[model samples]
Target: SAVISQKPSRDICQRGTSLTIQCQVDSQVTMMFWYRQQPGQSLTLIATANQGSEATYESGFVIDKFPISRPNLTFSTLTVSNMSPEDSSIYLCSVARTRGEGFSTEAFFGQGTRLTVV
Candidate 1:
C-alpha cells in the first residue's frame, strides 16, 4: 500500500495566476495520476504521469494547461497554468496499487489541493 500527500491543502488565487501542487508517495508506485474535482462535480482524470516519459493527458486536458512532471517513482507535480474562475476545484493526486501480473488494485488519493480562483 502507498500513502499520498499533497501540498497546499487549500488556497485562493487570482485569475490568470498559476499554482503548482506537489504530490509525494510513501512507497514507489507504478501508476500515478492527477485528477480534478469541480465544485459539486465528480472527479475528472487529468493525466497519468509516466516515470520517464511525457504525461498522457485526458481528452479535455492539454499539457500546456495542466503540465505534469514525474521525475521518479513516488513523486510528481501538477501545475494549473493560467488559472481562471472555472479552474477552481479540488486537485487530487492518486496512485494505484498493483497486485500480481501488473493488475491494479484500489487507487489511493491524497487530501487534495482546493484552489479557488478569484
Candidate 2:
C-alpha cells in the first residue's frame, strides 16, 4: 500500500488564474495518475505521469490546459492553466499497486484538492 498526500486541500480563485496541485507518495511508484471530479459528476481521468517521459493526457484534455510533471517516482504536479468557472472541480491524485500475482491492483488516492473559480 502507498500513502499519498496532496497540498492546498481547497482554494478559491478568480477566473483566468491558474492553480497547481501537488501530489506526493510515500513510496516510489511507476505510474501516477491525475483525475478531475466535477460537481455532481464522476471522476474523470486527466492524465498519466510517468517518470522520465512525457505525461499522457486523456481525451478532452490537452497538455496546454492541464500540464503535468512527473519529476520522480514519488512526486508529481498538475497545473490547471487559464482557469475558468467551468474548471472548478475536485482534483485527485491516484496510484495503483498490485496486490499479488494474477490479482488486480488496488488504487490509493489522496485527499483531493477542491478548486472553485469565481
Task: Using lDDT, give the best candidate's number.
Answer: 2
Cα lDDT of model 1 by residue, 1-118, tens digit: 6788899899999999999999999998876999999999999999999898999999999999999999989899999999999999999999987688868687899999999999
Q: Which residue ranges in model 2 land beyond 4 Å of their true spot?
A: none
Local distance difference test scores for all models: 0.94, 0.96
Give one digit per residue, the lDDT tens place, for model 2 in 16-91. 8899999999999999999999999999999999999999999999999999999999999999999999999999
Cα RMSDs, all models: 1.5, 0.7
Q: What lDDT score is found at residue 35 in candidate 2?
A: 96
Instruction: TM-score for candidate 2, please give it.
Output: 0.97
Error of 2 at 93 (Å): 0.3
What is the Cα-based lDDT of residue 90 in candidate 1?
A: 98
Worst 10-residue lDDT window, candidate 1: 97-106
